[model samples]
Target: MVIAWEDGHRSSYSGESLRWACPCAECRGEAGSPGRLARVQSLEADELRVQNVALVGQYALQIAFESGHSTGLYTFGLLRSMCDCPECRARKSAT
Candidate 1:
């Protein structure tokens, strides 16, 4: 998905990456718990792309992946933090 931030910056994310980064309790585990990084796990080729997308009450995105797993809601803050552009990546690394 592609997002235009309030700061006039744009970011894009892959279906698989977003799925892996799912913030749902079932995917990421209970809040404050540790064991959430599933985006780097092994996944089928079809799960690497997005099929459809929906907005969630102006706060998040409900993406339907080709894999049929569409329960996660990605918030704007999380999406912004997931940016993989060169500048974002550099900023992340420096932090």
Candidate 2:
């Protein structure tokens, strides 16, 4: 997916990377416990298939995958940080 930031910077990400970075409780966990994704040995193709996307108020997006996982609330800030475009990469490395 591609995001056109208000600053006119465009950021892009692939479905595979997004699925790998899922921040849901099941994927990221809580109380210092390891998440399910962390314990998984491999990812199925369906798990990385983006089925739908929904806006959450004005700050985040909730994405659903074909594998039936949809609890990740990807905030704008997090999404920005995840951008791997050359500009974003350079900016991050310079910091």
Candidate 3:
């Protein structure tokens, strides 16, 4: 997915990366439980690709991956926080 920030910056992310980064309760699991990445050990790389995307009240996104995972509600802030752009990466490293 791609996002154009209000500050005139553009950000893009690969579907596979986003799938692995799902922030849903199921994906994250209980405080110390195994996560989605751990549970999905047999998945092929193609299974992580996005199949569809839907907006959630203008605040978030609901993405369906090729493997049929689609419960995560990716908030805009969370999406921005996950940006892998050089600027975002540099800012995080600086902190």
Instruction: Give one digit per residue, the lDDT tens place, for model 2 in 13-85.
Output: 8889889889998998789999988999789999988999899999999989999999999999999999999
Q: Arrange candidates by lDDT, highest first: which order? A: 2, 3, 1
RMSD per candidate (Å) reads 2.9, 0.8, 1.9
Kindly report which residue pairs in candidate 2 clash with one another. none
Candidate 1: deviation at residue 15, Å?
A: 1.7
lDDT of each candidate versus the true structure: 0.81, 0.92, 0.85
lDDT by residue (1-95, candidate 3, tens digit) is: 78897889888989877887788878888789977667875567666788999999989999988888899898889889999889899999999
Q: What residue runs in model 1 are displaced by over 4 Å at the alpha carbon?
A: 31-41
How do these models rank on TM-score, best leading?
Answer: 2, 3, 1
Best by TM-score: 2
Query: Model 1, 88: alpha-carbon shift in Å?
Result: 1.4
1-95 per-residue lDDT for model 1 (tens digits): 78999999999887767878877786776766654454345777777678888999989988887878778888888899899999999998999
Better of 1 and 2 by lDDT: 2
TM-score-better candidate, 1 vs 2: 2
Return the TM-score for candidate 2, rounded to 2 decimals. Answer: 0.95
For all predicted structures, in order, the TM-scores are: 0.78, 0.95, 0.84
